[model samples]
Target chain A: MTRTSAIFRRELSGYFTTPLAYVFIVIFLVLAGVLAFFVGNFFDRGQADLQSFFVFHPWLYLVLIPALSMRLWAEERKSGTIELFLTLPIRLSEAVIGKFLAAWCFAGIALLLTFPFWITVNVLGDPDNGMILAGYLASWLMAGAVLAIGAAVSAGTKNQVIAFVVTAALVFVLAVAGTPTVLGLLQGWAPSSVIRAVAGASLFGHFTAITRGVVDLRDLVYFLSIMVAFLAANAIIIDLKKAD
Target chain B: MLEIRNLVKKFGPLTAVDDVSFSVPEGEVLGFLGPNGAGKSTTMKMITGFLAPTSGTAVICGHDIEAEPLAAKRRIGYLPEGAPAYPDMTAAEFLDFIAHIRGFHGIEARRRIAYIAELIHVGDVLHQPIETLSKGYRRRVGVAQALLHDPAVLILDEPTDGLDPNQKYEMRGIIRDLSPHKAIVISTHLLEEVEAVCSRAIIIAHGRVLADGTPAELAARSRYHNAVRLDLASDEAAGIAAELQKLPGVASVEAAADSGQATLWVFPQGGQPISDAIVRLARTQGWPVTGLYVERGHLDDVFRTITAPDATGNALRDAA
Candidate 1:
């Protein structure tokens, strides 16, 4: 536990030592506000809840989370710090989990900065604070899943560009998997059970379902499993390519 | 102590480290000598538990690297090739983080970092970003981090690769100062460094150990060992060459005149000492001698002869 925390503290502080964290947070806030008030039509909807504000989180995370995560392992490999890091007296699992937690916490910090939006809605009308709290949980969980996928993809290569592009593409497929158009395309060829599983397993499907003022245990499990499964793959990929 | 047993690493069909084995006890510094891609770094990686070996294990102190990696790693301090560190971190921050990883925290971590900084002479730049520091400072920071934990064993891969002459001298001084308490294995491209700091030298090529001995012992393997070179005031290249060739224990004598001055080389038969014999012959013949000395075999010659690409059949085998 102490070893994990040591890696965790170093990784977390590493984010703030560069401009990357600030740039990401600024972009996230600007895009979230623009999409919420301008494209999302928050006032026009006449709702006290932050439904419109929470609705665009999946779209926002699809682009931004990978940016935050591409450097998790790829930069370490390119700079050769991974050798010094892995040789320390720590387990591979601890390093993987510690890095993931750091990125996840960073995303959480950015999400917390969007608190003024919550206050805006509360001042505009009497909002259901419980539902808004659920929205925050759902948004943070979805971001965690995206960051986890990015972490695994970043470990496969030393090139951050490849990690960025591949992670964006993979998350894009997951975000649109449950849409009517995609399910319609899959109807003709894939088996019915497989198509149903794909639809149920879609990131957007689980994500959108939870942002509607309720957090389901199944949806929480889905997000946690994605994080766990991908983080496991991240550790395995690092161990596999350690020689390179 | 560090004991490696038949470590082998194979990437598909290509063998990178082929059954390499050696041991280093406390108070000994072993110099690992090899060319590029000679499996020197690869073997160090396996020993430090950074890369899993294809078919062997390293025992550090008493812990096996594969079975009890954390315990073994806790007892080891490794400076990987190029001395990689976080570019964004200040030297102090990196050391503090390393101290944390080594199970030191709070006051203890701070104390260790300060001590290491002073010992390695990095106290001046401890607060500067590692990227902004000079190459020598960066390399010293690497060594400092490896020494922060004060492990029982240290594995440094090319610790002084690009340092200036003074920095290289200081780096070797640091290695020698720490040699009495810990087992050290360092690999370098500079052969002279073997004589400078290493108590024992291991020459490896083609992923195998070609020779292992003290610096002098490896130098003795050269054909020039115990040979004598004589300088004559006379420019006659032929007369002295024939006369010196007949001396007992003298294998052959060759004389050459360069710019009107004659130089004679007497190679001893079967690695015998022939300087005394040549001195007596010079006195009896009344040859006008200016300078003469016995040649301790050149390490470069021994290195070249052993690792030559077209070596004879038996020379290709591991001599260690």
Candidate 2:
């Protein structure tokens, strides 16, 4: 546990020491705001909640999460510091969890910085603060799931660009898996069970369910299972590919 | 207290390290010598638990590297090839991180970092990021990181590779100072380094151990061991060469190309000292010998002879 904290501290501080973290946070905030008010038609809908703001989170994280995770393992491998890291007394799982948590915390910090949107809805009229809080929690969880997938993909190669591109493509597929466009296409030929399963597996579906002010146990389980499954995959991939 | 037993590492059809085995007791500095791509780094990686050996194990302080890697790794301070470190980190921060991972914390970590920085003479560059430092400073920081925890075993791969002569001397001094309590293994291609700091030496080639002995013992394997070389003013090279060969216990005499002065090298049949006999012969023949010396043998010659492509037969012949 001490070793994990040491790695976590080092990795967390690593983000703040560079301009990348500030740039990523600013871009995430500006893009989320613009997408919610302009593209999301928040005032036009006359909504008293932050549904518009929370709705853009999956898209916002698609670009930003990959940027955060591309360096987790790829940069370590590229700089040859992975040699020093792995030879330390820490276990493979500890290093994996430590790094993943650091990235997750950074994402959470960026998500929390968008609180003004929630405040705006509260000031305009009586809004469901409970739903807004659930939206924030679900947003953070979904971001963790995306970042976990990014972490696993990052371990497969030493090129940050490749990690980023591959992760973005993968998250895009997961985000669109349950949408009408994808389900409609699958409904034409696939079995009903296959389409339902695909719809159930969609990140967009679980995220939307939580944003509706109803946090189901199954929805929570979906996000948690994604994080756990991908994080475990990340550890396995790192162990198998570390020596290469 | 390190034992490496028949460690073999094969990557596909290429065997990077093959049946290489050696041990280092406390207070001994073992110099690992080999030509490039001869598996020196590969062996070190396997022993450090950075890479899994295809079929063998290394025991460090009673822990098997393959079975109990974390325990084994805790007792070892390894400097991998190229002295890899986080480029963006300052030397102080980097060392602190290493100290923490090695189980030091708070004031204890700070004290150890200070001690190691001063010991390795990296105090001046402690605040500079490793990427901004010169190659020598970066190398020193890498060394300091390895020594931060003061493990019982030190496995350094080319520690003095990029250092200048003075820094190399200081590094050797540090290794020597710490050698009494720790088992040290340093891999280097620098032949003189083995003689300078190593208490024992192992020469590997083609992923196999070719020779293991003290510096003097390995140097004695040279064909020129105990040979005599004479620089005389006389120019009758062929006549003198024949006479030198006829001397008792003399193996062969090779004369240098005819210059204004004559130079002849006389090998002994059994590495016997024939300098006095040659001096007497020079006096009787009225030949003025300008210079005379007995060879202690050259390590460069021995290294080349032992690692050459046809070295197996030549090595056996030389041994005979």
Specify the highest-lDDT model's number. Answer: 1
TM-score of chain B of each: 0.96, 0.95
Q: RMSD of model 2, in Å?
A: 2.0
What tens digits encode model 2's per-residue C-alpha lDDT throughout B1-320? Answer: 89999999999899999998899999999999989999999999899888889998999999999999999999999888889988878899999888988999999999998899888999999999889998888888988988888899999999999999998998999999999999999999999999999999998988989889988888888878999888888777778888888889899998875568888999998777888888898789877778888998888888888888795736653574
Model 2 lDDT per residue over A213-239, tens place:
999999999999999999999988987
Kindly report which residue stretches of model 2 are placed more than 4 angstroms away from their true locations once superposed: B233-238, B256-262, B311-320
- State in Å the error of residue B235, model 1: 1.2
Instruction: Evaluate residue A217 in candidate 2 and report its C-alpha lDDT on the 0 to 100 scale.
Output: 99
Residue-level lDDT of model 1, residues A1-244, one tens digit each, is 9888888888999989999889999999999999999998989999888888988999998889988889999999999999999999999999999999999999999999999999998899999999899889899999999999999999988899899999999999999999999999998999999999989889988888788766888999999999999999999999999866
Model 2, position A97: C-alpha lDDT score: 93
Q: Evaluated with TM-score, which candidate comes out highest?
A: 1
lDDT of 1 at B107: 94
Off by over 4 Å in 1: B256-260, B313-320
For candidate 2, the TM-score of chain A alone relative to the native chain A? 0.97
DockQ of 1: 0.91
> In candidate 1, what are the lDDT values of residues B151-247, reduced to their tens digit?
9999999999989999999999999999999999999979889999999999888888888999999888777899887888876657888888888
